[model samples]
Target: MEATELNIRISFGRKHALALLSAFFLCWHPGFIGSETLQLTTFYPAPYGGYVSLLTTGGTNTVPANTILARNAGRVGVGTGTPDSKVDIRIPVGLGANGVQITDDNANPDTRSYATLGVTRAASGNNLAYIGLTKQGTYPWAIGVAGSNDLIMGASSAGNRTIPSPMFSIDTGGQIAMGGGAEAGRRLRVVGDLRVTGDIYVNGRIQGLCQRIGYSITGVTSCPWNHNVIGFLGDGVARVSGFLPASATTSGVGRFIVLGEDWGGTMICCRF
Candidate 1:
């Protein structure tokens, strides 16, 4: 009998007969009717107008049923029956390759449209703003306002070294004016000329300013032959104990004289 007729006859048979006929039909209709394999090439497009289509090429055409083509098309109308619920849309992987290429092309300034990589400010007086690493490893030379045209006004290291203490530092080209400090234990040694307008008070013993007594001088030495007294001595000589004395006599024609006092003896000198 024909396959359709056999199927109709099996449908009305008793339970045991129906089972036997079902097995026979399965063996006979291997590639017939419902047993035929159906390969789906593409899904039937959804009736909705906003449904997105997924088309594939270069492979065996097999698409599963009920596969969501595009979850979110725009920043609105995704999953929600109302379009207002689609706030921020996302076209997940594979679906976004074409869209990304189009966006990149539009971002180029040479193209018709462009999108900014980041926020940018307008040029103010020929100056633009940028963000970058300020220092990598070594110490930077200087840092301050961009174009102020003034010497850095606050604490700075222009003429200073960081390793050593700068208490005795002196700027060669500039005058340093300090105020309101005891200034103890500070020693200043200058190889060049030092002009001081204020009084210098020495708290400790002042050395190396006087000649030693009982020290013989030869003719080759610069010492005066007449044993003229000069500055006071520090250790083995008479130290000048008080303020330096000035010449008492201002003579025009007669011999000039000076009278000074020291710790050992008084000084009386006459010179022309």
Candidate 2:
């Protein structure tokens, strides 16, 4: 049996103290990766850096097919390496995902409610160009400028990029059209019926049917209200009261009037 015992004298210096302190920090710090996992509850001063691509996978040690990229020119892309806008998201075709959705979490809403999403003019004093509703298999229906720079809402039937004639449109001067042809100085032009329950006014005058009266011409009667008699109702018989020559009964001139002529129609008269 052998027993060994060693005795050493330790001296303290600035370099030794620094080395020991550094080793102490390397053992328990979050950046240390010896054998245990690194868990960070909070970060101080936050993390700021640059990376070509950042990705997260569903499983460990698996690389994701799609990645999020942040470019140096301040563009961020999701599922794409290069983005054209400030923030762009690209979903693969035939995927179940569509576009973005915004939900309002307010459980109780009243008359004075706020919108979930809003589009406004840019800070450069330029108005918004257009807004569109697009589907996967159909052309987009959009509200935008026409070829002449007039504001219009239009749709297409042929292809994705094709712009068909507008089904409905509004011009720059606020004239509206139902058939896509908005003429100048016209307030509204509709191809279909224009129904109005109230009176129609043209040049400060209310337009309506003229007042006239009719009467059955079974006998000779004076015109009511002193209105002028226009014509008789009988066919080929001008006057109502007349004498017909007797032919069969060997009688004198028989007093007769055209009755049941024109199907017992009415006398026409109008106020002049």
Among these predictions, the greatest TM-score belongs to: 2
| Residue-wise C-alpha lDDT for candidate 1, range 1-272, written one tens digit per residue | 65553333334448888898989987786443333232333334555344443322222123321122223444332222233334422222332111111213332222323321211121122112111111222221221211222111122121111111122222233333122111224333433446789998988866644444532222222334545555443223333333333544533544434432223332332221
lDDT of each: 0.30, 0.50
Give one digit per residue, the lDDT tens place, for model 2 in 44-142: 454743343343322122221254666657787765656789897665443321233232454321111333221111111111233344444335554
Instruction: Name the TM-score of candidate 1.
Output: 0.17
- The list of candidate 2 runs beyond 4 A from truth reads 1-131, 157-160, 194-243, 246-255, 259-272
Which candidate achieves the best lDDT against the true structure?
2
Model 1 residue runs over 4 Å out of place are 1-186, 213-221, 224-272
